[model samples]
Target: MARRSDDAEQLLLPYPTTRRQRLEHLAHRAGGIARRVLRFVLRWLARILLPLLCAAALLQAFPYQATVQGVPFEVQGSLFTRPGLTADTTLGSWEFPDVSGVPFGVHVRPEDVDVLELTRLAGRDLPGFVEELRVDFAAEVPRIAWWLVAELVVGLAVGLAIAIALEMAVRHLRGRPRREHEVRQRLLQFGAAALVTLVVAAYGVLSYNENWVRESRLTGTLAAAQLFPGQLSSYYTEQSKAFDVLGSVVGIQAALQADIDDERTPDTAVRIMTISDMHLAATYPLVAQYAANYDVDLIVNAGDESAFGTSAEFTPEYRQAIADLAATTPMVWVAGNHDSPATVAIMRGIPGVTVLGTKTAVEDGFAVGAGVVEAFGLTIAGLPDPRVYGGPGAYGADAPDVVDPLQRAAVREALGMDDDEDGATDGGAADGENGGDGGAADGGAEGDPAGVDLFVLHEPAAADEVRELLPGQVRQTVSGHTHRQNASDELQDDDAAIELVEGTTGAGGLDNIVRGTERPPIAFSIESVSADCQFTRIVRFSIESAGPAADLGTDPATPQAYGDDVTVSTVYFRPQDVAEGRRCDTDLGVGAERPWADAG
Candidate 1:
């Protein structure tokens, strides 16, 4: 009865008897649980994580390899082999000595491997698996290697911390007094192991830069080294010498290769071919062939068919080419600086050719200058070279030049728009009446004239003045005389126009011949226009020189000329008809419904 009463009294005394004793008892229970958990984790690290880390390090240090055709090759991922064939053939003998008599260690790629055979050996679709592995290897190898090192460091730190915690917990649970010196000793040993692990990780990263460990099968006979002195010293030096010799011979061979099939056929409703500055070279046959093959509807020559605009310069060959072109397709000619009065008359004499002169007139709200030819469902205006009126020489006598400000005002008067009035230039009756079905008004500019679709001339420098004469309505202007081919930026401003400068088509006469650069940069444009006066596509054609100077018989000092190589490309423009809810396929019929009339 007394023992039972004593046990009840002790149980009711809060068990630990004091606050400090109660706290110690709770800590002992927690330490025991922590120790058990730490031991399990330590076992896992030893049995699983440690082995994985070692294996990864070993694989990275020495990559796996396979024998192909009796030649050992280092496998790059699963699909490729290291040291490509070019490197092996060029540097193998010297860099990798052939210890064995037979040439071994030749480079191989995945494509060279027999997938069927590999699959048979592995009894599965090894090639497909290998392909997937290759992609993963390329993307993840570098990241994975660094991740492995990071894992090692983190695992070591965590393991050491847990080990120290477990030791403390064990001592506390066993009712042993904490030994500070023994704990310090255990910590020092674990810390040293962690430090050693960190050092190994750093060394492993550095060792990745070293070449893979492999025995060289090639024997170092040095036979080729003895035969070709200085060849093995630098691979680049040998390559440089070889390319230099090849370059000298390449120029001549390139000149002979001509490719006319490269010309691009227009994919538009209406096709207009624009050629300029033909200074009387034998390019008309090629030009005629291009037009006929592509089924060109119209041909526009911006001028300079002769050097001095002399009658004698129009040789039989030149005339014959022009006659043949006009025979098949209707052509329009604008006078150039080089075209004299005699030259103009000769061109006008051609049955299908219409020659333009200098004058000012207005159609719709926009002023139409002299040489306005309405054909192929569009209005084409032209300006003669300003040099023909007052600049520098005898070239001015044959044709009058009206590029001055006063002449431009006259153009306004012809369009029936008063100067300085600044009246709105859109949605006017005269705009619709001038060209009738032949013209289409600018949808953006109200009360403005339908305006000219294309302005043809011999000098691109006159574009600014021309734009001033026909504000907000000139879509494009074609010109030549600089003997260069280039197009201006698209008309982005409300009143800007595109200026296309045609390069020399006749190879620039003596300038090209004397320099031995007879083949010149010649370009023609295939333009597609919608029935409602919108352009859909403007494809530019030009010749690119594929051969070197020696082949073209050009002087080494002379610049390379465009020859047989032809490149076709397109230029973008705002679609006018498409925006107006009109289809581009609307047929406007062939030829004029009535007799052709000039905008006078």
Candidate 2:
């Protein structure tokens, strides 16, 4: 009994004497081996992998050689301080590839590389090369830094997942039921070491493929260029080319000069070109060119220079373009309905441009009437559009009536007529001969006189009232509110005065987009008038078949559109004969009247 009790106590002792105890001992040994293996990996990562990752990051931040369009180029520096390239220039110096050598037009540094220089070096025109250089230099450091950070994050995540998976598999094979605390501790250490190793490997691999990095840097540098200088001269050149091409397509080139028989001096023959409702279209340069080419003595605009009349609509560029035109010839501006007070102020500020505002009043109702500008021995009067008095702030009223007694009184004052002794207005037959009132008689009419030689207004509807108030001495009337060329045809039968309506010169706000198969035509008229205002001749030219309308394919408002392209021809009319008993003739012949008149 004593021997059996002693044997049982021995069996219960902490020793591998039974099968279950032996299996537990084997699991303990395997765990010890796994711990040593994990320690080795952690030490290796700290010693070898961490330093490698740091080195790779440093290398990525440095400058390197890149091939751009088959030519070797060096890319360096950050944005602002050290931007641009190192290239050959005969005009400037060259030095080290540093920020100090950037081209700021400083005499102490090397010349800055430009698109033109790059084109010369590559033997090809690189359109956007300069812009590409600007963008790449500005964005390089940030882009690379972001890419490296992303790779590091991904590598670390992948490595941790792999380490945890391996640890789980080993525990399964060893047949050890992992305790929660032990599993968590082992995973943390192994995952940390694996993460370091993978991050280092990924960075090293990326650094080894240096060619790919260089090529990526050069991607945008080798493409076609799209940027150009925004200087005024550059703007004019580009706009001029586009306008010239469009004009040629629409036959404006053919209608530049007039076929006239008169041989008067520049002083005797006043050549006037009328344009109106330009609405900020891209056609100003073309109009200016035509005026210059035709040697126009006076240019008249009937307003609508801006569509919305906002200050933004009148850019410095637009003012410069107008100044360019005013520099070439005398221009008269009449305020249209679209013109705001700001627009008037801008026009008044332009040198050599005559702005006929409401202050240039000859009479009460004619407060907006411009007095007179005597050019080519003729007195020309200007009247602002009556609608100018009805807007928000101009006349202090909305839609005020203008075609009434007040306008008649203003017309009478403009014509230099006076009230009779009985308070009835005189017919002004004597005033027409005596040059009565403040009216100047310097024109060819001289002592044999009359009222103003030419009357310029905004709307054609006021033509009859103005002529009726005149002393029968006014030769021709010019207006532009109606965008159509044939707006004069709707005048009352008793309105025998020769009225010329200048059509929309700036495409009636068609903008760059033209629609439909039927093109809109622009009219440019050259009027050759004697200083006496008698024997007036007008040569009208049209630019037809320009292009499709803005809503051609999408909207049906302008079907059969020609887009400003039409046959180029000239129509001549003599206002003197037309004012008399004779009819208006396109050929200015005695019997052959205009076809439109014959149709009625």
Candidate 3:
């Protein structure tokens, strides 16, 4: 046995570990037992820690008390540290009640807001009064990540490589030929290589270098802040909420731009309802109901009053029938690309609806609602039929109107626009599988361009084109193809011509929309409030016809003067009733064109 021990010793190198090492290994085993006891306690701590974290998350997700008691311009922008800060706690009296578990209140002072607007912004609804400042946890991430990642990778690589190398070297020196010993040596070698690989792959290559990071992180600190209620903010938000609700419930938010000059301003009280793209046979009842009962002095059919476009989509009797539907009311009809010239002729022949499509002299005028004498005040001219890519889906025009005349003409020519033998417009050919017959591409008319009070068409781009074609001459433009109501506040003034959209008032989604919204889902687009089956009271207003309206304090019933002090008190038309359940249902819309999923 002694000789065998010597042989074992001989197998090891000169500086190999001796019998003393076994004693040290025993000491290490004792230390390991103590570590396991420590680990058992840590495991219990970790279990409790997870539940505490869950409770914290729950508390964070629950909404806190919201006290809106101060100003209309509440804290919408970034808070704190940005100046123009009003004195803190400049009280107009702020208070709040506790909410479900969470609490918050009127955290803004009166000095922080505009005084006159205080009444509008302050909270009438106070739900809480607790303020727990959370350190917007997202802000801490970049700082911790800053130079540390690369450095961490380097340190980890160096330390792990050394640890693994030491294990392998120690194994070799001991000359341990045990199966477990050789396995341990090979594992250490692999771990060393993996460490080097991870450092280079993750940190050295993937991480953004110091200079690039600095350029990107210039203003991250500017974004972080805690949310709390303020007086002016609350008041403004409440007013906005009130307007949004009333506007939505009232149905005008879809296409009526009433109160063009804000209620705050003493302007003419004008209520307008415009409907376009009335695909007559399909959604006539919905349009008729809106037109017959809604509180609109001016009801307009922008264009495509019928789906009578070419020989295929149009039947002369159907055209006459659709035109007859509007014969009862003083309807103003424009031509869509879909309407054939024959369909247009039938429309012009209709007694009640004055067709403003073919460009004629000053005497051959059209209707633009109630007032507006030809040549002096308002004028209506018909636009040529718009070009189509074989059918409707083939064409795609999205940019702003082309400015240069030569460029515009070239575009028209490229689209296959040319005059027919009778000098009438012969439609051009379209490009691609989606192309259509192109004719109305450049929005020019057949006769003298009398200054129109408004230009009407089927698409919004048509108005933009007419404006581009005539520069300053065309004042107001109305269009509809979306089969939805859209009104413009930006496009009106004294000598102001605005664009109005009145289409598919409440036929929900007759225009490719799987789901519609009361609030605009996209940032750039306006939210449309759908018209319900109720009687809508639209106040017809003539520009500058009456004196400024009285500030009757948010009361719709308050009698007020029109601009120029006209005492025109119109009667309220009664509203229709709802279909079945409570409010209007626009989401799960179904039916012919709606289910077909394409626009006119």
Candidate closest to the true structure, highest TM-score? 1
> Against the unseen true structure, what C-alpha lDDT does each candidate score?
0.50, 0.47, 0.34
- The TM-score, computed over Cα atoms with residue i paired to residue i, of candidate 3 is 0.33
Cα error of candidate 1 at position 8, Å: 94
Count of steric clashes across candidates, in order: 22, 30, 56
Error of 3 at 368 (Å): 20
Please give, for residues 1-600, the per-residue lDDT of candidate 2 as tens digits.
889999988887867878988999999999999999997797555444444443343333443444433234443333223223233222211222222222211111122434333444433222243335335544554554454455444444544555555656766898979767976775676566667656654654554422211111111101000001112233324334443222221121112121122243222345778888877765656667666655677787877787655678888877887888888777878776566666777887887677753433223222544444444444456666544333433232222264444444444444345554321133322233222222234222344333445667766655556766553545566777556675322321332346777777765664223223232466657666553344344545455534433444422112123231222223333334211221111122111111111111
TM-score of each: 0.45, 0.42, 0.33
The candidate 3 region of ten consecutive residues with least summed lDDT is: 218-227
| Residue-level lDDT for 361 in candidate 3 | 15
Model 1 TM-score, 2 decimals: 0.45
lDDT of 1 at 518: 50
The worst-scoring run of ten residues by lDDT in candidate 1 lies at 252-261
Arrange candidates by lDDT, highest first: which order?
Answer: 1, 2, 3
Better of 1 and 2 by TM-score: 1
What is the alpha-carbon lDDT of model 3 when measured against the actual structure? Answer: 0.34
lDDT (C-alpha) at residue 451 in model 3: 32
Query: Candidate 1: which stretches are off by over 4 Å?
Result: 1-267, 358-369, 388-432, 441-449, 487-497, 511-520, 544-562, 577-600
Residue ranges of candidate 2 with Cα displaced over 4 Å: 1-268, 357-367, 389-440, 447-449, 487-497, 510-520, 531-535, 545-564, 567-569, 575-600
